[model samples]
Target: MTLTGHSLIAGEAVAGTEGRAFGINPSTNEQLEPAYGLVSTEQLRAATAAAADAFKPFSSLEPVRHARFLETIADNIEAIGDELIERASAETGLGAERLRGERARTTGQLRLFADVVRRGDFRGVRIDPALPDRTPLPRADIRLRQIPLGPVAVFGASNFPLAFSVAGGDTASAFAAGCPVIVKAHNAHPGTSELVGQAISRAVRDLELHPGVFSLVYGAGTSIGQELVADPAIKAVGFTGSRAGGTALMRTAAARPEPIPVYAEMSSINPVYVLPGAVRGDADALARQYVASVTGSSGQLCTSPGLLFVPAGEDGDRLADAVARALTGQAGQTMLTEGIASAWQQGFRSVESAAEVELLARGQAGTTANAPAPAIFSSNLDVFTGNRVLHEEIFGAASLIVRYKNVEDLAEATDLLEGQLTASVQATEEDYASAAALIPVLERKVGRIIINGWPTGVEVGHAMVHGGPYPATSAPSTTSVGTLAIHRFLRPVSYQNFPQELLPAPLQDANPWQVNRLVDGEAEIQPR
Candidate 1:
């Protein structure tokens, strides 16, 4: 079967002018279809211009009307959620069940943004009353509101076709905030991206939005991404990919005359600390859970637990054996792309070269179409602390188990961990109490700290932060999940001496919206 999904520009599917990239199915190692060629400089300019122009009218729409548009998009996405997931699985080689769950999360995120708009939380409006005094001159009132950044460019990730692709969270948040989007589809799943892009197109028409509000382009090289971010019309960018790729685009954005904000959620190790008490009590269950987390989606998730810290003793040995057996029992599947598979192999070789690390069990290699079975390694904390490569993300179904001799050993390992999206602590109540001394140290190293849980399943809700310092993400203050993500699309604007008629609704004395906010120094739900 073959399918060619062309580039979408100005609400229309357009072919590339200069070059073409073939789409390779990771599941079969066979070419499925041809994707649109690299978007030339001219195409990038046109797309950027369309988005900039579209933003003017979209940003001017009333918040309520904007909220309705977002709801319509969510409705359209949900209506075709099944088809989206199926195609995503076929293209990217992810399992059907996992993709289905990701689809639900993706649509749920879109609706969450709708709810945020409906509640007027994103308005971020504030007002200070005018003051009249006899001894001093009268002062006019001050008002503040969120304004949309002009246009945003989004880069889809290879592992998550539906949730992080053309119509993913980055696009959904930008669209909900009244910022038009220009998406650069990942080559691994261009066909799936095209399908979802069409859904979004139908949505825009149904909601009576500008045709130029969205554009999806495809290219093999870095040129398209560079052109998009460097374009004067683009105001910001959202990216999820490797550090090398993200850093290149970030540098391009930073070099521009008017540097723009680039929110890039790069990869991470997402370490887990297994205390002695938990291992002593029930090492088997924790090992089984780790196996599932490590092999889930072939360890393609950015939050997969790559580096594990196990306490030393007879219990630690039992936990190691159980985890190794569990991973060996699970069958390995094809990765999202061949490039990823090759990289995984390269990482495996590197781990094999480490002197102190011992290979416990290695799954048999499969055909080129499938990845090798999961592998596990055992080592001491000394080796892990000495080698910086041990902390880097391997991006496959592989884990390194490090044994800690004492509290000091565990603390040393925790202190050396890089910034991560999640840090899991597997400990009994007593062990949890014992580790209280190291809790604050771990807190500063990760965005979210989990107890008796795996970090693979990221929930999309308020207070869900999928970002961390440095390698986990480029910006810690921003998050890729939840309604708070809309902040990326908004900037603050302050107004003074404005007439009552000219005042924004949120600043109006009527307090028509009745949204929760801070007034003076107190929390309230009324206009000044």
Candidate 2:
């Protein structure tokens, strides 16, 4: 499984004439080989055209074979083994242990989607029988089931190269929904993208699926990416990147003749609120955990707690001091790319220069090229609420702390904030009264609420939500993680007065797919 600089298009290794770019090792600032070839307009169109050609067969694949296809992708990715991990580590500065876990997540996501396909619940079946003799006007027989969108264009994220890249959640969900996919490999890790792209290609070959079911292309700049979204063949998009980047894609999709939906996870300043009783419970330990979450992955994670609220009193002072000490002992690690490190520095300086903010603590710098020192700042509720710059995400190992005089001030501060992926609350039983009052406010502003915990690690499961309103993600009704993400690529179709022989398998009277259905407003249970 050697790395090639070519793009994988419809099961073919297509060399790009557009341009070439190399993945750089952020830890050492060294160029990695071989230089990846960027796709031309012609090549990009070829991939999408292939995808459109594949949608008919790929979307209609039988349940058993479709599930096996996903499983085979996981097996092929595991077969790549150490070479995959080593290449990903070099391309991105993430540690080996972390990449190993991410690799498992990537494979686990594919396997999870495989299970979803086998169950066939994603088809979302419903039926209403004809009422022939009940009334003057007979009701017509109707059935409904979800169908796949034609094709999807997925943009990789810079932070999680494995779990958010080529064979990540977006691709897995789209495949589970039975849509073909075209992935635009993130520029920061082309070599890593190539490896995973090859694994998916192998899976397509092994299962004898349509060749265009999956395609991975490289882009030298924004032109190729924007063109992908504007292409008529692509019906929807899955994107995880900067807010600006996500919005740009959104605009392109909207400007198209046939506007499409762009499911983009842009930015978040996941906030943490520390109730008075909880601050009194274990200030020292809470401060340490807070700093740990801030500095994890050099604070590049989207869910990192960017803002923290503490009670204003003697107990709060003790907690603030603990936070300072904890931050001072911490150190930053190598970031994913030089560009990301540069942006983090710029954002940190802007927040540090604000007159209302006071520097609480600054940590030691890492012993690498792109790694920078971590820092924390402090202010009051008035300053945080009044200053718009203070409310923005710094996108690095920097955080801001604001003290509130009472529960009313805390609730007001929470109300003023923008949409977030998560909001964490540290509270004891004694503080539940105050914490309970703020729950509705948090429900309006964030997607997930955490009690007595941090917001760094995201669990991949059926009920987990990795999305939110507005700035957190473009689509408030959808999630970019877990099993529910499959709905992003599905659209419901209703059949009325149709013959039983013409009905799709899932909507058929006999339930040939063995999927559960809602029949005449009643549950029609089926064996798993």
Reference-based lDDT, each prediction: 0.81, 0.92
lDDT (10s digit) by residue, model 2, range 1-528: 877899999999999898898999999999988988999999999999999999999998999999999999999999999999999999888899999999999999899999999888889898999888767788889899999998999999999998988999999999999999999999999989999999999999999988999999999537999999999999999999899999999999999999999999989999999988898878789989999999998998999999999988899999999999998877779989999999989988998899878999999899998899998999999989999999898888999999988887787888888899999999899988998899999999888999999999998889999998889999989999999999999999999999989999898888888888899999888876
**Candidate 2: minimum summed lDDT over ten consecutive residues — where?**
407-416
Write out the backbone clash pairs for model 1. 19-37
What would the per-residue lDDT of candidate 1 be over residues 143-254, giving only the tens digit for each residue? 7888789899999998888788787788888987879999998888877878777777777788788878988888753788898999999999999999999888889999
Give stretches of model 1 more than 4 Å off: 1-4, 134-140, 366-368, 511-516, 526-528
Q: Which one is best on lDDT? A: 2
* Candidate 2 Cα deviation (angstroms), residue 283: 1.5
What total of clashing residue pairs does each candidate reach?
1, 0
